[model samples]
Target: MIMRQAWLSSQVLSRVEPNGQAASVWRFFAGALFPIQLGSRGVRRIKNIAYGPEGRKHLLDIYLPKGPATAPMPVLLHVHGGGWIVGSKHQQAQPLIQYMASQGWLVIDINYRLAPWNRMPVMIQDVIRAVAWTKANITSYNGDPDFVALTGGSAGGHLVALAALASNVDGLRPELGDADCTVDACIPVYGLYDLLDQNQAMEVGVGEIRSFMTRFVMPKSYSEDAALWEKISPINHISPSAPPMLILHGQHDSLADLESAKAFAESLSRISKNKVTFVDLPGQQHAYDCAYSPPAPEHARAVHRFLESVRKDKQR
Candidate 1:
Protein backbone atom coordinates (compact mmCIF):
# COMPACT_ATOMS: atom_id res chain seq x y z
CA MET A 1 0.00 0.00 0.00
CA ILE A 2 2.87 2.33 0.78
CA MET A 3 4.53 1.50 -2.52
CA ARG A 4 1.22 2.00 -4.31
CA GLN A 5 0.83 5.45 -2.81
CA ALA A 6 4.40 6.37 -3.68
CA TRP A 7 3.98 5.12 -7.26
CA LEU A 8 0.76 7.05 -7.50
CA SER A 9 2.44 10.19 -6.33
CA SER A 10 4.72 9.94 -9.34
CA GLN A 11 2.24 8.76 -11.98
CA VAL A 12 -1.24 10.28 -11.77
CA LEU A 13 -2.33 13.37 -13.70
CA SER A 14 -5.85 14.34 -14.83
CA ARG A 15 -6.65 15.44 -18.39
CA VAL A 16 -9.78 17.56 -18.85
CA GLU A 17 -11.07 19.99 -21.41
CA PRO A 18 -13.26 23.13 -21.74
CA ASN A 19 -13.75 23.21 -17.95
CA GLY A 20 -10.14 22.32 -17.06
CA GLN A 21 -11.02 19.88 -14.27
CA ALA A 22 -7.66 18.10 -14.15
CA ALA A 23 -7.15 15.25 -11.68
CA SER A 24 -4.08 16.45 -9.84
CA VAL A 25 -1.83 13.84 -8.27
CA TRP A 26 -1.31 16.40 -5.53
CA ARG A 27 -5.09 16.58 -5.32
CA PHE A 28 -5.27 12.80 -5.24
CA PHE A 29 -2.99 12.43 -2.19
CA ALA A 30 -4.02 15.70 -0.58
CA GLY A 31 -7.26 14.31 0.84
CA ALA A 32 -6.80 12.28 4.00
CA LEU A 33 -7.70 8.63 3.61
CA PHE A 34 -11.14 7.86 5.00
CA PRO A 35 -12.78 4.58 5.93
CA ILE A 36 -15.12 2.87 3.48
CA GLN A 37 -18.21 5.04 3.87
CA LEU A 38 -21.21 3.19 2.51
CA GLY A 39 -24.69 4.73 2.38
CA SER A 40 -25.49 8.23 3.45
CA ARG A 41 -27.76 8.70 6.49
CA GLY A 42 -29.79 11.37 4.76
CA VAL A 43 -31.31 9.08 2.14
CA ARG A 44 -34.19 6.60 2.05
CA ARG A 45 -33.69 3.40 0.11
CA ILE A 46 -36.74 1.90 -1.55
CA LYS A 47 -35.62 -1.41 -2.91
CA ASN A 48 -36.75 -3.94 -5.53
CA ILE A 49 -38.80 -1.81 -7.90
CA ALA A 50 -39.29 -3.83 -11.06
CA TYR A 51 -38.12 -1.87 -14.06
CA GLY A 52 -38.77 -4.59 -16.56
CA PRO A 53 -40.50 -7.90 -17.15
CA GLU A 54 -37.46 -9.96 -16.21
CA GLY A 55 -37.53 -11.16 -12.60
CA ARG A 56 -34.68 -10.11 -10.34
CA LYS A 57 -32.34 -8.83 -13.03
CA HIS A 58 -34.72 -6.09 -14.04
CA LEU A 59 -35.35 -4.76 -10.57
CA LEU A 60 -33.86 -1.48 -9.30
CA ASP A 61 -33.50 0.41 -6.06
CA ILE A 62 -34.57 4.01 -5.57
CA TYR A 63 -32.26 5.96 -3.25
CA LEU A 64 -34.22 9.08 -2.53
CA PRO A 65 -33.36 11.81 -0.08
CA LYS A 66 -35.60 11.57 2.98
CA GLY A 67 -36.64 15.16 3.34
CA PRO A 68 -39.09 16.95 1.07
CA ALA A 69 -37.42 18.59 -1.87
CA THR A 70 -37.74 22.10 -3.27
CA ALA A 71 -38.63 20.41 -6.55
CA PRO A 72 -37.99 17.19 -8.43
CA MET A 73 -34.35 16.24 -7.85
CA PRO A 74 -31.94 15.24 -10.57
CA VAL A 75 -31.88 11.52 -11.33
CA LEU A 76 -28.77 9.33 -11.53
CA LEU A 77 -29.25 5.91 -13.15
CA HIS A 78 -26.33 3.68 -12.17
CA VAL A 79 -25.36 0.49 -14.03
CA HIS A 80 -22.83 -1.46 -11.96
CA GLY A 81 -19.50 -2.65 -13.33
CA GLY A 82 -18.32 -6.26 -13.50
CA GLY A 83 -16.71 -6.54 -16.86
CA TRP A 84 -19.68 -8.16 -18.68
CA ILE A 85 -20.14 -11.17 -16.45
CA VAL A 86 -20.50 -10.57 -12.71
CA GLY A 87 -22.18 -7.64 -10.96
CA SER A 88 -25.50 -6.42 -9.58
CA LYS A 89 -27.22 -3.09 -9.01
CA HIS A 90 -25.76 -2.90 -5.55
CA GLN A 91 -22.40 -4.43 -6.45
CA GLN A 92 -19.63 -1.86 -5.86
CA ALA A 93 -21.91 1.19 -5.94
CA GLN A 94 -22.61 1.52 -2.23
CA PRO A 95 -20.25 4.43 -1.61
CA LEU A 96 -21.46 6.45 -4.55
CA ILE A 97 -25.14 5.69 -4.07
CA GLN A 98 -24.94 6.53 -0.38
CA TYR A 99 -23.11 9.79 -0.97
CA MET A 100 -25.25 10.89 -3.89
CA ALA A 101 -28.42 9.97 -2.03
CA SER A 102 -27.32 12.14 0.88
CA GLN A 103 -26.87 15.03 -1.53
CA GLY A 104 -30.61 15.11 -2.28
CA TRP A 105 -30.12 13.36 -5.62
CA LEU A 106 -32.54 10.62 -6.57
CA VAL A 107 -30.44 7.64 -7.63
CA ILE A 108 -31.69 4.56 -9.49
CA ASP A 109 -29.38 1.60 -9.03
CA ILE A 110 -30.13 -1.18 -11.52
CA ASN A 111 -29.12 -4.75 -12.31
CA TYR A 112 -28.92 -6.20 -15.81
CA ARG A 113 -28.45 -9.61 -17.39
CA LEU A 114 -24.84 -10.79 -17.63
CA ALA A 115 -23.21 -12.60 -20.52
CA PRO A 116 -22.78 -16.38 -21.28
CA TRP A 117 -26.43 -16.91 -20.37
CA ASN A 118 -27.43 -13.54 -21.80
CA ARG A 119 -25.52 -12.35 -24.89
CA MET A 120 -24.70 -8.99 -26.38
CA PRO A 121 -27.40 -6.35 -26.84
CA VAL A 122 -29.37 -7.89 -23.96
CA MET A 123 -27.30 -5.90 -21.48
CA ILE A 124 -27.65 -2.74 -23.52
CA GLN A 125 -31.35 -3.48 -23.97
CA ASP A 126 -31.78 -3.83 -20.22
CA VAL A 127 -30.13 -0.43 -19.80
CA ILE A 128 -32.51 1.10 -22.34
CA ARG A 129 -35.52 -0.42 -20.60
CA ALA A 130 -34.35 0.99 -17.29
CA VAL A 131 -34.03 4.42 -18.80
CA ALA A 132 -37.49 4.15 -20.29
CA TRP A 133 -38.85 3.15 -16.93
CA THR A 134 -37.04 6.03 -15.25
CA LYS A 135 -38.38 8.53 -17.78
CA ALA A 136 -41.94 7.29 -17.40
CA ASN A 137 -42.01 6.93 -13.62
CA ILE A 138 -39.27 8.98 -11.98
CA THR A 139 -41.56 11.96 -11.48
CA SER A 140 -43.51 10.03 -8.85
CA TYR A 141 -40.27 9.58 -6.88
CA ASN A 142 -39.54 13.31 -6.93
CA GLY A 143 -36.99 12.80 -9.70
CA ASP A 144 -36.68 15.10 -12.65
CA PRO A 145 -36.90 12.77 -15.61
CA ASP A 146 -35.68 15.49 -17.93
CA PHE A 147 -32.26 15.60 -16.30
CA VAL A 148 -31.38 11.93 -16.00
CA ALA A 149 -27.64 11.26 -15.83
CA LEU A 150 -26.05 7.88 -16.43
CA THR A 151 -22.90 6.54 -14.72
CA GLY A 152 -21.01 3.32 -14.15
CA GLY A 153 -17.60 1.69 -13.96
CA SER A 154 -16.11 -0.85 -16.40
CA ALA A 155 -18.95 -2.70 -18.18
CA GLY A 156 -21.44 -0.32 -16.66
CA GLY A 157 -19.30 2.49 -18.00
CA HIS A 158 -19.41 1.02 -21.49
CA LEU A 159 -23.19 0.64 -21.42
CA VAL A 160 -23.90 4.16 -20.15
CA ALA A 161 -21.56 5.67 -22.73
CA LEU A 162 -23.12 3.67 -25.55
CA ALA A 163 -26.68 4.41 -24.49
CA ALA A 164 -25.94 8.14 -24.27
CA LEU A 165 -23.73 8.65 -27.31
CA ALA A 166 -25.14 6.21 -29.81
CA SER A 167 -28.36 8.06 -30.54
CA ASN A 168 -28.76 6.36 -33.90
CA VAL A 169 -28.56 2.86 -32.48
CA ASP A 170 -31.84 1.07 -33.20
CA GLY A 171 -33.82 -0.08 -30.24
CA LEU A 172 -32.74 -3.73 -30.01
CA ARG A 173 -36.10 -5.01 -28.82
CA PRO A 174 -39.58 -4.69 -30.33
CA GLU A 175 -40.99 -3.59 -26.97
CA LEU A 176 -38.48 -0.74 -26.98
CA GLY A 177 -39.72 0.68 -30.24
CA ASP A 178 -39.46 4.45 -29.90
CA ALA A 179 -38.14 4.16 -26.36
CA ASP A 180 -35.89 7.14 -25.91
CA CYS A 181 -32.36 6.40 -24.58
CA THR A 182 -31.25 10.00 -24.40
CA VAL A 183 -29.48 11.17 -21.24
CA ASP A 184 -28.35 14.61 -20.07
CA ALA A 185 -24.80 13.43 -19.21
CA CYS A 186 -22.59 10.44 -18.47
CA ILE A 187 -19.54 9.58 -16.31
CA PRO A 188 -17.74 6.40 -17.40
CA VAL A 189 -15.03 5.26 -14.96
CA TYR A 190 -12.29 2.91 -16.15
CA GLY A 191 -14.60 1.82 -18.98
CA LEU A 192 -13.69 -0.17 -22.02
CA TYR A 193 -13.85 2.24 -24.90
CA ASP A 194 -12.94 0.50 -28.15
CA LEU A 195 -13.64 -3.19 -27.90
CA LEU A 196 -13.19 -3.81 -31.58
CA ASP A 197 -9.40 -3.39 -31.52
CA GLN A 198 -9.27 -3.14 -35.30
CA ASN A 199 -5.80 -1.70 -35.21
CA GLN A 200 -4.78 -4.38 -32.71
CA ALA A 201 -3.30 -1.47 -30.80
CA MET A 202 -4.95 -1.89 -27.40
CA GLU A 203 -2.48 -2.71 -24.63
CA VAL A 204 -2.07 -5.93 -22.61
CA GLY A 205 -5.24 -6.05 -20.45
CA VAL A 206 -7.36 -5.82 -23.60
CA GLY A 207 -6.07 -9.09 -25.04
CA GLU A 208 -7.87 -10.99 -22.29
CA ILE A 209 -11.12 -9.21 -23.16
CA ARG A 210 -10.91 -10.44 -26.77
CA SER A 211 -10.77 -14.03 -25.61
CA PHE A 212 -13.31 -13.67 -22.80
CA MET A 213 -15.84 -11.70 -24.85
CA THR A 214 -15.62 -14.10 -27.76
CA ARG A 215 -16.37 -17.05 -25.53
CA PHE A 216 -19.20 -15.82 -23.32
CA VAL A 217 -20.15 -12.26 -24.20
CA MET A 218 -20.26 -12.27 -27.99
CA PRO A 219 -22.95 -14.32 -29.63
CA LYS A 220 -20.73 -15.34 -32.56
CA SER A 221 -17.05 -15.81 -33.30
CA TYR A 222 -14.95 -12.68 -33.77
CA SER A 223 -14.24 -13.79 -37.33
CA GLU A 224 -17.95 -14.19 -37.99
CA ASP A 225 -19.06 -11.03 -36.17
CA ALA A 226 -16.49 -8.28 -36.22
CA ALA A 227 -19.17 -5.77 -37.09
CA LEU A 228 -21.22 -6.49 -33.98
CA TRP A 229 -18.12 -6.04 -31.86
CA GLU A 230 -17.61 -2.68 -33.49
CA LYS A 231 -21.28 -1.89 -33.06
CA ILE A 232 -21.17 -2.29 -29.29
CA SER A 233 -17.92 -0.41 -28.78
CA PRO A 234 -18.84 2.97 -27.24
CA ILE A 235 -16.02 4.78 -29.01
CA ASN A 236 -17.62 3.72 -32.29
CA HIS A 237 -20.82 5.61 -31.46
CA ILE A 238 -19.71 9.12 -30.62
CA SER A 239 -21.81 11.92 -32.17
CA PRO A 240 -22.06 15.67 -31.94
CA SER A 241 -24.75 15.52 -29.28
CA ALA A 242 -23.05 13.29 -26.68
CA PRO A 243 -23.99 14.37 -23.19
CA PRO A 244 -21.48 16.09 -20.94
CA MET A 245 -19.10 13.37 -19.73
CA LEU A 246 -16.32 12.88 -17.20
CA ILE A 247 -14.06 9.94 -18.06
CA LEU A 248 -11.92 8.54 -15.19
CA HIS A 249 -9.56 5.62 -15.72
CA GLY A 250 -6.90 4.25 -13.41
CA GLN A 251 -3.32 4.85 -14.43
CA HIS A 252 -2.61 1.31 -13.32
CA ASP A 253 -5.79 -0.29 -14.63
CA SER A 254 -5.17 -3.62 -16.31
CA LEU A 255 -8.81 -4.38 -17.08
CA ALA A 256 -9.57 -1.22 -19.05
CA ASP A 257 -6.90 0.02 -21.48
CA LEU A 258 -5.56 3.41 -20.42
CA GLU A 259 -4.55 4.76 -23.83
CA SER A 260 -7.85 3.78 -25.38
CA ALA A 261 -9.66 5.38 -22.48
CA LYS A 262 -7.72 8.59 -23.05
CA ALA A 263 -8.45 8.48 -26.77
CA PHE A 264 -12.12 7.98 -26.11
CA ALA A 265 -12.26 11.10 -23.97
CA GLU A 266 -10.19 13.06 -26.47
CA SER A 267 -12.48 11.95 -29.28
CA LEU A 268 -15.59 12.97 -27.39
CA SER A 269 -14.01 16.29 -26.58
CA ARG A 270 -13.34 16.86 -30.25
CA ILE A 271 -16.77 15.89 -31.54
CA SER A 272 -19.25 16.89 -28.87
CA LYS A 273 -20.06 20.46 -27.99
CA ASN A 274 -20.72 19.43 -24.40
CA LYS A 275 -18.08 19.62 -21.70
CA VAL A 276 -15.75 16.59 -21.38
CA THR A 277 -13.50 15.95 -18.39
CA PHE A 278 -11.00 13.08 -18.28
CA VAL A 279 -9.03 12.17 -15.18
CA ASP A 280 -6.16 9.67 -15.10
CA LEU A 281 -6.30 8.48 -11.51
CA PRO A 282 -2.80 7.57 -10.40
CA GLY A 283 -2.06 4.43 -8.38
CA GLN A 284 -5.78 3.86 -8.13
CA GLN A 285 -7.11 0.53 -9.27
CA HIS A 286 -10.02 0.13 -11.63
CA ALA A 287 -13.38 0.72 -9.91
CA TYR A 288 -11.56 2.87 -7.36
CA ASP A 289 -14.64 4.98 -6.67
CA CYS A 290 -16.37 1.87 -5.34
CA ALA A 291 -14.10 2.30 -2.31
CA TYR A 292 -13.76 5.23 0.05
CA SER A 293 -10.33 6.84 -0.21
CA PRO A 294 -8.46 9.76 -1.68
CA PRO A 295 -9.41 9.60 -5.37
CA ALA A 296 -12.67 7.84 -4.64
CA PRO A 297 -14.16 10.47 -2.37
CA GLU A 298 -12.55 13.27 -4.33
CA HIS A 299 -13.79 11.85 -7.63
CA ALA A 300 -17.25 11.14 -6.28
CA ARG A 301 -17.45 14.71 -5.07
CA ALA A 302 -16.32 15.78 -8.52
CA VAL A 303 -19.08 13.70 -10.08
CA HIS A 304 -21.61 15.24 -7.73
CA ARG A 305 -20.39 18.64 -8.81
CA PHE A 306 -20.66 17.62 -12.43
CA LEU A 307 -24.17 16.29 -11.93
CA GLU A 308 -25.07 19.50 -10.14
CA SER A 309 -23.79 21.48 -13.10
CA VAL A 310 -25.76 19.32 -15.48
CA ARG A 311 -28.89 19.75 -13.38
CA LYS A 312 -28.51 23.48 -13.34
CA ASP A 313 -28.00 23.51 -17.10
CA LYS A 314 -31.12 21.44 -17.64
CA GLN A 315 -33.18 23.80 -15.52
CA ARG A 316 -32.04 26.78 -17.54
Candidate 2:
Protein backbone atom coordinates (compact mmCIF):
# COMPACT_ATOMS: atom_id res chain seq x y z
CA MET A 1 0.00 0.00 0.00
CA ILE A 2 2.31 2.69 -1.30
CA MET A 3 0.95 5.79 -2.96
CA ARG A 4 2.86 7.11 -5.96
CA GLN A 5 4.64 10.23 -4.83
CA ALA A 6 4.80 11.51 -8.41
CA TRP A 7 1.08 11.15 -9.03
CA LEU A 8 -0.52 11.05 -5.61
CA SER A 9 -3.05 13.80 -4.98
CA SER A 10 -5.70 13.79 -2.28
CA GLN A 11 -8.04 15.54 -4.70
CA VAL A 12 -7.81 12.65 -7.17
CA LEU A 13 -8.16 10.18 -4.35
CA SER A 14 -11.35 11.89 -3.21
CA ARG A 15 -13.20 10.22 -6.08
CA VAL A 16 -12.40 6.76 -4.78
CA GLU A 17 -12.47 7.45 -1.07
CA PRO A 18 -14.38 10.06 0.90
CA ASN A 19 -11.76 9.58 3.59
CA GLY A 20 -8.27 10.77 2.56
CA GLN A 21 -6.51 8.12 4.63
CA ALA A 22 -7.76 5.36 2.32
CA ALA A 23 -5.38 6.57 -0.47
CA SER A 24 -2.44 4.90 1.21
CA VAL A 25 -3.58 1.52 -0.09
CA TRP A 26 -2.31 2.28 -3.59
CA ARG A 27 1.21 3.23 -2.48
CA PHE A 28 3.79 2.96 -5.21
CA PHE A 29 7.16 1.35 -4.68
CA ALA A 30 10.16 2.74 -6.56
CA GLY A 31 11.46 -0.74 -7.16
CA ALA A 32 11.49 -4.15 -5.54
CA LEU A 33 13.16 -4.81 -2.18
CA PHE A 34 16.71 -3.45 -1.95
CA PRO A 35 19.05 -5.89 -0.21
CA ILE A 36 21.18 -4.20 2.46
CA GLN A 37 24.35 -6.23 1.81
CA LEU A 38 24.13 -5.56 -1.92
CA GLY A 39 23.44 -1.92 -1.06
CA SER A 40 25.03 0.85 1.03
CA ARG A 41 27.82 0.07 3.42
CA GLY A 42 27.93 2.18 6.59
CA VAL A 43 31.73 2.07 6.34
CA ARG A 44 31.75 4.44 3.33
CA ARG A 45 32.38 8.18 3.24
CA ILE A 46 29.34 10.29 2.38
CA LYS A 47 30.14 13.66 0.91
CA ASN A 48 27.71 16.42 -0.16
CA ILE A 49 30.19 17.89 -2.63
CA ALA A 50 29.44 20.72 -5.06
CA TYR A 51 30.69 21.79 -8.52
CA GLY A 52 29.83 24.01 -11.56
CA PRO A 53 30.96 27.56 -12.32
CA GLU A 54 29.21 30.85 -11.36
CA GLY A 55 29.41 29.18 -7.97
CA ARG A 56 26.37 27.16 -8.95
CA LYS A 57 25.86 24.64 -6.18
CA HIS A 58 25.19 21.34 -7.92
CA LEU A 59 25.29 18.77 -5.14
CA LEU A 60 26.84 15.32 -5.56
CA ASP A 61 26.39 12.35 -3.21
CA ILE A 62 29.71 10.53 -3.11
CA TYR A 63 30.26 7.07 -1.60
CA LEU A 64 33.94 6.32 -0.99
CA PRO A 65 35.08 2.93 0.22
CA LYS A 66 37.19 2.55 3.36
CA GLY A 67 40.65 1.83 2.00
CA PRO A 68 44.29 2.94 1.94
CA ALA A 69 45.34 6.26 0.39
CA THR A 70 48.24 4.76 -1.57
CA ALA A 71 46.00 3.30 -4.29
CA PRO A 72 43.78 4.91 -6.88
CA MET A 73 40.31 3.34 -7.29
CA PRO A 74 38.15 3.58 -10.39
CA VAL A 75 35.08 5.85 -10.22
CA LEU A 76 31.60 5.54 -11.69
CA LEU A 77 29.41 8.63 -11.93
CA HIS A 78 25.73 7.65 -11.95
CA VAL A 79 22.93 9.86 -13.30
CA HIS A 80 19.34 9.09 -12.22
CA GLY A 81 16.51 8.88 -14.75
CA GLY A 82 13.03 10.28 -14.21
CA GLY A 83 12.53 10.82 -17.90
CA TRP A 84 14.51 14.02 -17.23
CA ILE A 85 11.19 15.47 -16.08
CA VAL A 86 11.09 14.21 -12.49
CA GLY A 87 13.61 12.38 -10.27
CA SER A 88 16.35 12.93 -7.75
CA LYS A 89 19.80 11.53 -6.94
CA HIS A 90 18.57 10.31 -3.55
CA GLN A 91 15.87 7.88 -4.65
CA GLN A 92 16.05 5.84 -7.89
CA ALA A 93 19.88 5.88 -7.86
CA GLN A 94 20.65 5.02 -4.24
CA PRO A 95 20.41 1.28 -4.74
CA LEU A 96 22.79 1.08 -7.69
CA ILE A 97 25.22 3.62 -6.25
CA GLN A 98 25.35 1.69 -3.03
CA TYR A 99 25.73 -1.61 -4.88
CA MET A 100 28.56 -0.41 -7.16
CA ALA A 101 30.50 1.11 -4.27
CA SER A 102 30.05 -2.07 -2.30
CA GLN A 103 31.75 -3.85 -5.19
CA GLY A 104 34.78 -1.57 -4.49
CA TRP A 105 34.27 1.27 -6.99
CA LEU A 106 33.90 4.82 -5.79
CA VAL A 107 30.36 5.88 -6.75
CA ILE A 108 29.23 9.44 -7.33
CA ASP A 109 25.52 10.07 -7.81
CA ILE A 110 24.89 13.48 -9.35
CA ASN A 111 21.77 15.61 -9.71
CA TYR A 112 21.13 17.88 -12.71
CA ARG A 113 18.53 20.55 -13.46
CA LEU A 114 15.30 18.99 -14.73
CA ALA A 115 13.30 19.91 -17.85
CA PRO A 116 10.66 22.68 -18.39
CA TRP A 117 12.94 24.80 -16.24
CA ASN A 118 16.00 23.74 -18.31
CA ARG A 119 16.59 22.13 -21.67
CA MET A 120 19.00 20.46 -24.17
CA PRO A 121 22.70 21.24 -23.69
CA VAL A 122 22.11 22.54 -20.17
CA MET A 123 21.29 19.07 -18.85
CA ILE A 124 24.36 17.68 -20.52
CA GLN A 125 26.39 20.56 -19.13
CA ASP A 126 25.20 19.77 -15.62
CA VAL A 127 26.51 16.22 -15.92
CA ILE A 128 29.85 17.44 -17.24
CA ARG A 129 30.03 19.87 -14.36
CA ALA A 130 29.53 17.00 -11.94
CA VAL A 131 32.28 15.03 -13.63
CA ALA A 132 34.55 18.04 -13.35
CA TRP A 133 33.67 18.32 -9.69
CA THR A 134 34.53 14.69 -9.17
CA LYS A 135 37.89 15.05 -10.94
CA ALA A 136 38.97 17.81 -8.61
CA ASN A 137 37.80 16.23 -5.35
CA ILE A 138 37.63 12.43 -5.84
CA THR A 139 41.22 11.84 -4.73
CA SER A 140 40.28 13.16 -1.30
CA TYR A 141 37.65 10.40 -1.28
CA ASN A 142 40.23 7.72 -2.21
CA GLY A 143 39.09 7.57 -5.82
CA ASP A 144 41.36 7.69 -8.89
CA PRO A 145 40.22 10.67 -10.88
CA ASP A 146 42.07 9.36 -13.94
CA PHE A 147 40.17 6.08 -13.97
CA VAL A 148 36.63 7.49 -13.97
CA ALA A 149 33.89 5.82 -16.01
CA LEU A 150 30.24 6.73 -16.80
CA THR A 151 27.09 4.68 -16.17
CA GLY A 152 23.32 5.39 -16.06
CA GLY A 153 19.94 4.12 -17.22
CA SER A 154 17.41 5.71 -19.65
CA ALA A 155 17.70 9.53 -19.53
CA GLY A 156 20.58 8.98 -17.15
CA GLY A 157 22.17 6.82 -19.82
CA HIS A 158 21.73 9.59 -22.36
CA LEU A 159 23.52 12.00 -20.03
CA VAL A 160 26.32 9.48 -19.40
CA ALA A 161 27.04 9.20 -23.12
CA LEU A 162 26.63 12.94 -23.59
CA ALA A 163 29.18 13.71 -20.88
CA ALA A 164 31.77 11.42 -22.47
CA LEU A 165 31.30 12.87 -25.97
CA ALA A 166 31.13 16.50 -24.86
CA SER A 167 34.36 16.42 -22.84
CA ASN A 168 35.95 18.87 -25.28
CA VAL A 169 32.94 21.18 -25.46
CA ASP A 170 34.05 24.67 -24.44
CA GLY A 171 31.45 25.49 -21.82
CA LEU A 172 31.81 22.70 -19.21
CA ARG A 173 35.06 24.21 -17.86
CA PRO A 174 36.39 21.60 -15.46
CA GLU A 175 38.60 22.96 -12.67
CA LEU A 176 40.74 19.84 -12.68
CA GLY A 177 43.50 19.76 -15.31
CA ASP A 178 41.94 18.21 -18.42
CA ALA A 179 43.89 14.92 -18.18
CA ASP A 180 41.97 13.65 -15.17
CA CYS A 181 38.61 14.68 -16.64
CA THR A 182 38.34 12.50 -19.71
CA VAL A 183 36.19 9.36 -19.36
CA ASP A 184 37.93 5.96 -19.56
CA ALA A 185 34.78 4.10 -20.62
CA CYS A 186 30.97 4.24 -20.63
CA ILE A 187 28.16 1.85 -19.66
CA PRO A 188 24.73 3.12 -20.81
CA VAL A 189 21.66 1.05 -20.00
CA TYR A 190 18.50 1.26 -22.18
CA GLY A 191 19.34 4.74 -23.37
CA LEU A 192 17.31 6.83 -25.78
CA TYR A 193 19.64 7.83 -28.63
CA ASP A 194 17.60 9.64 -31.31
CA LEU A 195 14.96 12.26 -30.62
CA LEU A 196 13.37 11.85 -34.03
CA ASP A 197 13.20 8.12 -33.50
CA GLN A 198 11.88 8.66 -29.99
CA ASN A 199 9.21 10.98 -31.31
CA GLN A 200 8.16 8.34 -33.81
CA ALA A 201 8.36 5.66 -31.18
CA MET A 202 6.02 7.66 -28.99
CA GLU A 203 3.41 7.75 -31.73
CA VAL A 204 3.21 3.99 -31.29
CA GLY A 205 2.34 4.47 -27.57
CA VAL A 206 6.01 4.28 -26.58
CA GLY A 207 5.89 8.06 -26.51
CA GLU A 208 5.51 8.22 -22.75
CA ILE A 209 9.14 9.28 -23.07
CA ARG A 210 8.00 12.56 -24.57
CA SER A 211 7.55 13.74 -21.00
CA PHE A 212 11.32 13.54 -20.50
CA MET A 213 12.20 14.87 -23.96
CA THR A 214 9.93 17.86 -23.52
CA ARG A 215 11.41 18.34 -20.08
CA PHE A 216 15.00 18.54 -21.37
CA VAL A 217 13.95 21.01 -24.07
CA MET A 218 11.10 23.28 -23.04
CA PRO A 219 10.49 24.98 -26.36
CA LYS A 220 6.96 23.48 -26.56
CA SER A 221 8.00 21.76 -29.78
CA TYR A 222 11.07 20.03 -31.16
CA SER A 223 9.92 20.70 -34.76
CA GLU A 224 11.22 24.27 -34.61
CA ASP A 225 14.90 23.34 -34.54
CA ALA A 226 16.62 20.61 -36.57
CA ALA A 227 20.15 21.50 -35.59
CA LEU A 228 19.38 21.51 -31.87
CA TRP A 229 18.31 17.89 -32.07
CA GLU A 230 21.49 16.92 -33.89
CA LYS A 231 23.61 18.96 -31.50
CA ILE A 232 22.26 17.28 -28.38
CA SER A 233 21.80 13.75 -29.61
CA PRO A 234 24.77 11.54 -28.49
CA ILE A 235 24.60 9.07 -31.37
CA ASN A 236 25.73 11.64 -34.00
CA HIS A 237 28.84 12.78 -32.10
CA ILE A 238 30.80 9.51 -32.20
CA SER A 239 34.51 9.85 -32.99
CA PRO A 240 37.54 7.63 -33.48
CA SER A 241 38.96 8.89 -30.22
CA ALA A 242 35.84 7.86 -28.31
CA PRO A 243 36.48 5.54 -25.38
CA PRO A 244 35.25 1.99 -25.10
CA MET A 245 31.42 1.77 -24.79
CA LEU A 246 29.28 -1.00 -23.37
CA ILE A 247 25.54 -0.56 -24.02
CA LEU A 248 22.89 -2.77 -22.38
CA HIS A 249 19.26 -2.90 -23.48
CA GLY A 250 16.24 -5.10 -22.99
CA GLN A 251 15.01 -6.92 -26.07
CA HIS A 252 11.50 -6.16 -24.83
CA ASP A 253 12.15 -2.50 -24.12
CA SER A 254 9.13 -0.56 -25.39
CA LEU A 255 10.34 2.92 -24.54
CA ALA A 256 13.71 2.71 -26.35
CA ASP A 257 14.61 0.38 -29.16
CA LEU A 258 17.48 -2.07 -28.79
CA GLU A 259 18.41 -1.06 -32.33
CA SER A 260 19.57 2.33 -31.04
CA ALA A 261 22.25 0.68 -28.90
CA LYS A 262 23.25 -1.52 -31.83
CA ALA A 263 23.62 1.49 -34.07
CA PHE A 264 25.68 3.34 -31.47
CA ALA A 265 27.96 0.36 -30.92
CA GLU A 266 28.36 0.02 -34.70
CA SER A 267 29.25 3.69 -35.01
CA LEU A 268 31.78 3.40 -32.19
CA SER A 269 33.34 0.38 -33.86
CA ARG A 270 33.59 2.13 -37.22
CA ILE A 271 34.94 5.38 -35.83
CA SER A 272 37.20 4.38 -32.93
CA LYS A 273 38.12 0.81 -33.95
CA ASN A 274 37.72 0.23 -30.21
CA LYS A 275 35.74 -2.34 -28.31
CA VAL A 276 31.99 -1.60 -28.14
CA THR A 277 29.89 -4.25 -26.47
CA PHE A 278 26.09 -4.32 -26.92
CA VAL A 279 24.12 -6.66 -24.69
CA ASP A 280 20.41 -7.31 -25.24
CA LEU A 281 18.90 -8.89 -22.16
CA PRO A 282 16.09 -11.19 -23.16
CA GLY A 283 12.59 -10.71 -21.67
CA GLN A 284 13.65 -7.58 -19.87
CA GLN A 285 12.40 -3.99 -20.03
CA HIS A 286 13.81 -0.52 -19.49
CA ALA A 287 15.39 0.06 -16.07
CA TYR A 288 15.25 -3.64 -15.35
CA ASP A 289 18.47 -3.34 -13.43
CA CYS A 290 16.73 -1.08 -10.94
CA ALA A 291 14.61 -3.95 -9.75
CA TYR A 292 15.41 -4.57 -6.10
CA SER A 293 14.89 -8.24 -6.77
CA PRO A 294 14.77 -9.01 -10.46
CA PRO A 295 13.32 -12.23 -11.80
CA ALA A 296 16.40 -13.12 -13.82
CA PRO A 297 18.15 -9.77 -13.30
CA GLU A 298 20.81 -10.52 -15.88
CA HIS A 299 21.20 -6.77 -16.50
CA ALA A 300 22.57 -6.04 -13.03
CA ARG A 301 24.87 -9.07 -13.18
CA ALA A 302 26.19 -7.98 -16.58
CA VAL A 303 27.17 -4.60 -15.18
CA HIS A 304 29.26 -6.26 -12.46
CA ARG A 305 30.99 -8.37 -15.12
CA PHE A 306 31.71 -5.31 -17.30
CA LEU A 307 33.18 -3.39 -14.35
CA GLU A 308 35.39 -6.35 -13.50
CA SER A 309 36.68 -6.44 -17.06
CA VAL A 310 37.38 -2.71 -16.96
CA ARG A 311 39.33 -3.15 -13.73
CA LYS A 312 41.40 -5.94 -15.26
CA ASP A 313 42.08 -3.83 -18.32
CA LYS A 314 43.18 -0.96 -16.11
CA GLN A 315 45.59 -3.20 -14.20
CA ARG A 316 47.08 -4.46 -17.47
**TM-score of each candidate structure, all chains considered together:** 0.88, 0.76
The window of 10 residues in a row where model 1 has the poorest summed lDDT is 9-18
Candidate 2 local lDDT, 158-192, one digit each (tens): 88887777676654434445544578888887887
C-alpha positional error of residue 268 in candidate 1 after TM-score superposition, expressed in Å: 1.5
Candidate 2 segments exceeding 4 Å error:
1-38, 42-47, 53-57, 67-70, 93-95, 170-180, 198-220, 295-298
lDDT of 1 by residue, 1-316 (tens): 8446533532333223224555555535543454455466688899999999899999999998887899888899999988788988777767678878888889999989998899998898888889889998999988988889999999999988887877447644326667676889998888988886643557775668888898889898779987778888888878888899988887788778888888788878999988888878667677767765565555666678777877677778
Whole-model lDDT per candidate? 0.78, 0.64
Error of 2 at 289 (Å): 1.4
Global Cα RMSD, each model: 3.5, 10.8
Question: lDDT (0-100) at residue 225 of candidate 2?
Answer: 61
TM-score of 1: 0.88
